[model samples]
Target chain A: MTPLPRWADVVLLPLLNVVLAFLVGGLIVLAVGQNPLQAVGIMLYGAFGYGSGFGYTLYYTTDFIFAGLAVSLAYHAGLFNIGPEGQAYVGGLGVILLGLALNGAHWAIVFPLMIICGGAFGALWAFVPGYLQAKRGSHVVITTILFNFIATSMMGFLISRVLKPVGVNSDESAPLEAITRVPQLRTFIELFKNSPVNLTFFLAIIALFFIYWLIWRTKFGYAVRALGQNPVAANYAGISNQKMIMIVMAMSGVLAAMVAVNNVGGVQGRLILNFVNGAGFVGIAVAFMGRGHPVGVGLSALLFGILYQGGQELAFQMPGITREMIVTIQALVILFTGAMGDMLRAPLARLLARSSSPTGAK
Target chain B: MESYLVDITLILDSTVRLAVPLILACLAGLYSERAGIVDIGLEGKLLAGAFAAASMSAVTGSAWLGLLAGIGAALMFSGIHGLASINFKGNQTISGVALNFLAAGLTTFLGQSWFKRGGYTPQLSGDQRFNPITLPFAEQLREVPILGQIYFELISGHNIITYFAFIAVPVTAWVLFRTRFGLRLRAVGENPKAIDTAGISVTRLRYQALIITAVLVGIGGAYLSIAQSAGFNNNMSAGRGYIALAALIFAKWRPGPALLVCLMFGFLDAVQFRIQGQVFPIIGEVPVQAIQALPYILTVILLAGFIGRAVAPKASGIPYTKER
Candidate 1:
């Protein structure tokens, strides 16, 4: 059986998976007593339907976009960058440490530089496991997960002792200077009053286009495709498997770090220990649902953004639904999306079978 | 010397309790992985079991029933992993990760909704919870100089599961070594294609191994809720299942070695707990983070392919296809 056109897979496959996931996963949501339509409606409304919610939703979707690209970058080069949460946290650590050191620098260059540093820091942190996976052939999953625990604990230590935000008991670093804040119309941005939805979202869109271009248009993309399609083949074709592995992981880590940068510079203006909040991990789902493509991952991320928003509305309005339900949906998307390739193969093959075949091949 | 003597015994006793969960889980992993299934969802099953045990024990007021319920829940959850990965050929790691999230969410949701306890389940009474059943009060023998304290602390004051856990370790060894089924399961893991050609049903073996893994993990989960804490909290397994995975590797995937690895891990954990105040006091009262991290660090250092080679089963995570 032949595969779908690579072009159509990029455009339509993720949407189809998501549509199917929602329909199928609806049974699960209904079993839990949530009205799936209303729940989805509430989610959509909460994210983009009304008030400042749309801004807030897009704002976080940017982070999702960042994480999605991060996961996809690794996916391209045949690496599973599972330590995004850890990388993001470590990036946040870098952000606050740098922000503090440069306490009152102008937002233009200083902020952008810090953001780059955030990405660089995340890249470096992920490089540890990436290098290990390439060199020592350690299981990336175990190493990344182990790193998450260490990251959490290390962050806990840093927040409580070294970066303790004065007068606040919560585990967090002190707030960044107003000068360091990402430019945003926090005041009088009609409907969304206090949201930190700023230029970061635009940055995320720019990143998406850049990633899409990188994956499809460049020679590097060919190398990544070569590596991911079959590492052995890629190596046989004169590509450096070790180099690509490390580079792709670093790229994934950079994407993950962008999540931290957005969270600190725009939203929280400080590192919240809870900031990781599984967003980095959820990127795995986004990457799969998006089919390791930038645009698909972006839209899929928006779908989750809607879920997050709607789940909140449902929880608030009905008290029966829980935010955890949204989490379940997120996890379910990954579960179903991972099987997405298999799900399509037989059906697509059957549908597009040759005319000589009786009643279309099954 | 006296303090050292007491601390060592305490650590050993705690080691046994902690070891039960890890041992049972590693055994669970053995069954699945030995059949080339790579049950990464052991952690999820453990969490589901913990939740089921905690909730059921509270409702039924029977620790035994709760244990059974926990096992049933784990089996169901693990079955989902099996069905998705084995039948549908989904990515095992993603499925396992999803199960982990699902377990965390569903447990937390139910725990909060029904129990009104946020992320924790309702607390049970002494009888409802598993407690240490001290050995038949030996009046004179427990008074021996050094051995007495060791015997009392190490062997006595453990719930019934602890003793059963140790027993199961050897039983697992026997099953894997002495039994025909063990050989088949191991053969399937190492070379399922050969096993398939040999006329052994790889499907049946994998299914059976997964079910067995679920039940064992169920016991560990029950131990977590009913025996260890008597209350269910969100993510209470707290990566112990992964530690078991690490132990499985540290033990070279052998039952006896796995058991020793579990005990060593438990001892490390106990030492971490015991050294809460004295060791590097800057990290505050709960020194568990550094201590908890020790196993993972050791795993990386050990399996950085430095000490030895660890090769997974040839077709560990891949779904088998008749055509292929």
Candidate 2:
């Protein structure tokens, strides 16, 4: 078997896996007595058929980009930062606190403040587990998983007990002043008319370039990649694995924290419980499907964005294909792209080898 | 003093009840990890088990059938994990995570489709659910003070699943320490090459470990839905599987210590339940969230300093290949 070309490995493989996952999803739909083609049609229409639908898809895409980048950044450092849910949750608190404190401040001032504070909060939340992994010998995966629950309970407490307005629902904070809210995309762009997509989408694109530069261009990036590839060899080359782990994890947390900024400041305009939802977990799959590269992450994030919006449409159009069923489909995608990724790799490699070989010369 | 005694009993009772599921999950992880397989998918298996148990009980009106069905479903998931990690030589963590998503998605989808109550099964009634069992002479023992209170409150009046959970701990400890299979399991975790040299199939050992783990996790999930509550709710495991992971770590991968650690976590949960809304003048009403976060906080603290370096099985999480 021959090795796949870089393009095939990067672009074509994930696309094929996605197709396979969709086929299996179609089978599931059939088992449930629904036409797979009709469902797909509805989903496509729901995700991209209209302007507002496209805007909403892009809005979710913004979230997945932030989260996928977070996971990808950590993956480069040979770490699985599963605590993004916690980090994003804590980051929401930071954004909310800043928004509340600077309630009457200009949008320009508040936005930057939110980014700094939110990033710091998220980084700080992750830093403890990172420090433990680096110095205390605790596995990052275990600590991060535990932190997710802690973060949830902490957010629940804060939203209900401290930030909640009296005589109102205990699960959400009082709305921030309109001055702090980012204008919706529809306000500035005719294409995204009447949708929640906002300026954060532009920020996500900027982040993509920034991460690409950080990971591929710099000496520190080289050191991180080296350590991830071979820690013993990297250590022999005088790289401090401890320092790199800490910095990379903190960076990962910062990216994850941005999701809160997008959701709370841009979309919700208020802090709500579980606003991060399962975006953090979904990010793991995004990074996996994307192959932990900036461009790959961006493309996969868009794919997932479409899936989210389209899944909702499919659920609405077909009662049998419930929202949870969409989750099942998403899970199948993750399974094929992640856990069972190698299922088609060997066969495809052989096929490519056979096609490219000089048969007549041989 | 009398009220304090009653409170202690109440807390102990809740602690025992809560610890049952946690103990089962910890033991499940213990077996798998000991066999050199990292089972982060315990949460998934537990949830699948809970759903199966609840749905089957709701339909068949037999808790035992629900228990068997739960075990079967959990085993199916565990088999997938084994096939992926063992046969495909895939990343164990990724496989585990995928299993979790699959369980979460599948259970809800099936439950919603079948029962139509937003992914919750129909609530089981008396004969279909595991009810608390009163001990022999419990009514007569009420007047016997401390021993009677211990017997009636702490020891007795829990479902049969609780008894199985407690018994399983000792059995697990014995199996891990006393038997030849136990030695092989320990050897497999520490150094699979050594076992391979001894002409044993590492894959089979790992698969057996996973099967045992799944059955235990299944029972844990069944205990949650059928004994703790009458029906299964979506994502009903609610991170207890992770708490069990913390317990496994806190116990330093030993069975006896794992059980004790699970109980300790349960006690923390019971305390959190009792003190959720209480106000204190000096501290200004400890928020329920702080109490809920206590076990995780303590686990982190223990992982960092309190416990001296908890070492996992040496080969755990590394896919063992015959050639490599």
Candidate 3:
């Protein structure tokens, strides 16, 4: 059979899967005796209707973008790194420590330092699992999953026992000094007035470009892709499997950890328990749906950002659509885009092949 | 001395209870993975089972019927995973992860709308839940010292599902070793082509393995909602599935070793539950987080080859094709 066009293979298949997923979500809403059309409209309005709503969407988008990039980069090296959630949690601790230690420092200095510390901590956390997988033959998936739980427990300890404000009686660090907080997008730009969307949104955009170069344009990127495609062949061609594994995992960890900067420095300006939530896990689906491409990751992240913001709005506006409904919608998207992607891709490929064939016959 | 004895009994009792779910899930993974299907969606299956059992029991007021419903829901999910990974040649890991997201999202959404209690099912009551079962003469034997304590508290008083979990370990070992189906299942996992050439259907064997896994995982999940607790709360499985996966690895994917590993992990969980803010001699008030993180740390250590190798089935995670 003739191969489907690159555009169709990369874009069309996922787009169709996404549409079908939303359709299934609509049917689910209908089953619950709600108007699917009305629900969709409400979500759209909630996500994009107002300045704050849009800002929140972008804010969430930044988190997903970082996580999606993290997973996507790891995918390039044939590693399924599910440790981003853990990495981000550890990174938050680094950000919290840096913020507390540098309280009263200029934002110019504190901001960069926070990024560095977050990246370092996240990389450190991921390093052991990567090292184990590469050298000891441990399965990355299980190791990364175990690390997530470890990270959660570690974060709980640090926040409550050591990092807790003297008398707060809560499992959270003290609010960062105002000078250490990054400006919200509204303050930074007049067009985004009254929104919580912050400077990290632009940072995420820059990250998108950087990841694109890292994955597609560089020698290191070529090695990573080669390792992913054929590790034995890559090793034969002079790429060290051990070194690639470590570098890819470290890079993935750094990207995952950067979400701490967005949440800690930009949005909340304080370290709170579970601030990363499930965004890192959601990155797995984002990368899968995006087909491990930067542009695809960016687009899927934006879509998730809308769903998160709009789902909340939908719940508030129409009480029938509960917050959990949004989670179901997200699941449906994951199911279609990741698990059952072939439902669309296979048939579409066959159809495309048939149409493109010279004889137009089987 | 008596207080120490009481504390030991309490922790052991909790370990037995907590280990029930882990044991069942571990056995489920054993069947699926031994058949060459890496069932990472055990967590998703458990959550789905919990939600189904809790909601059904709440509606029908029959814990038995709730169990059936839970198994049914889990089977449907396993079928989806099988079809995707086996038939469609999709990435099994991705499918499993997607199944997890699906279960987490759908159960909460449906639970919220049906019961309107913030994504929790209505609480089960009386006959609607699986009450603890006392073995014959357990209370009469309570005065018999250590033997009495072990019989009554540690072994006898658990819910029926817990007893089944204990029984399941030996039964699984028997099925995997003594039965022809077990031999075929292991062969399919190791080399599907050989199984196919031997006049056996590889797809059928794998599907059957997954179905068994679904049933066992379903029971494990149902036990959590109906027996361990009164009803299902959102995300109630609480990563026990992953811990079971860790236990599976810790046991090197063998059924007999898996039981011990699960119990060990359960003991860690029990410690976590009981050891909060307790002062130890050297550590000086051990953090709850450290206790909670122990199982994962142990898993990392084992996987790092500090212990013997944990090898998977030769053909595990690779989709089988007719030609190759």
Backbone clash pairs for candidate 2 read none
Ranking by DockQ: 3, 2, 1
lDDT of each: 0.80, 0.88, 0.88
Error of 1 at B93 (Å): 1.3
Error of 1 at B100 (Å): 1.0
lDDT of 2 by residue, B1-324 (tens): 978988999999999999999999999999999999898898999999999999999999999999998999899999989988888888788888888888888888888778889889998889789999998998789878888988888898999999999999989989999999999999999999999999999999999999999999999999989989999999999988888988998899999999899999899889988887788788877888888888898888888876577889999999897774
TM-score of chain B of 3: 0.98
Q: Compose the digit string of candidate 2's lDDT tens values, residues A88-175.
A: 9999999989888888787888888888888998998888789999988888888888899899988898898889999895579989
Evaluate model 3: give its lDDT. 0.88
Off by over 4 Å in 1: A1-16, A165-168, A185-188, A347-362, B137-140, B279-288
TM-score of each: 0.93, 0.96, 0.97
Between prediction 1 and prediction 3, the one with superior lDDT is 3
What is the DockQ (computed on Cα atoms) for candidate 3? 0.74
Interface RMSD, all models, one decimal each? 2.0, 1.4, 1.4
Model 3 agreement with the true structure over B1-324: per-residue lDDT tens digits: 978887899899999899999999999999999889998899999999999999999999999999998999899999999998889877788888878888988898888778889888987989888888999999999999888977888878788899899999999999999999999999998999999999888899999999999999999999999999999998999999999998998898899999999999899889987877678898788888888899989889988889787888988888788973
Docking class of 2: medium
Worst 10 residues of 3 chain A by lDDT: A324-333
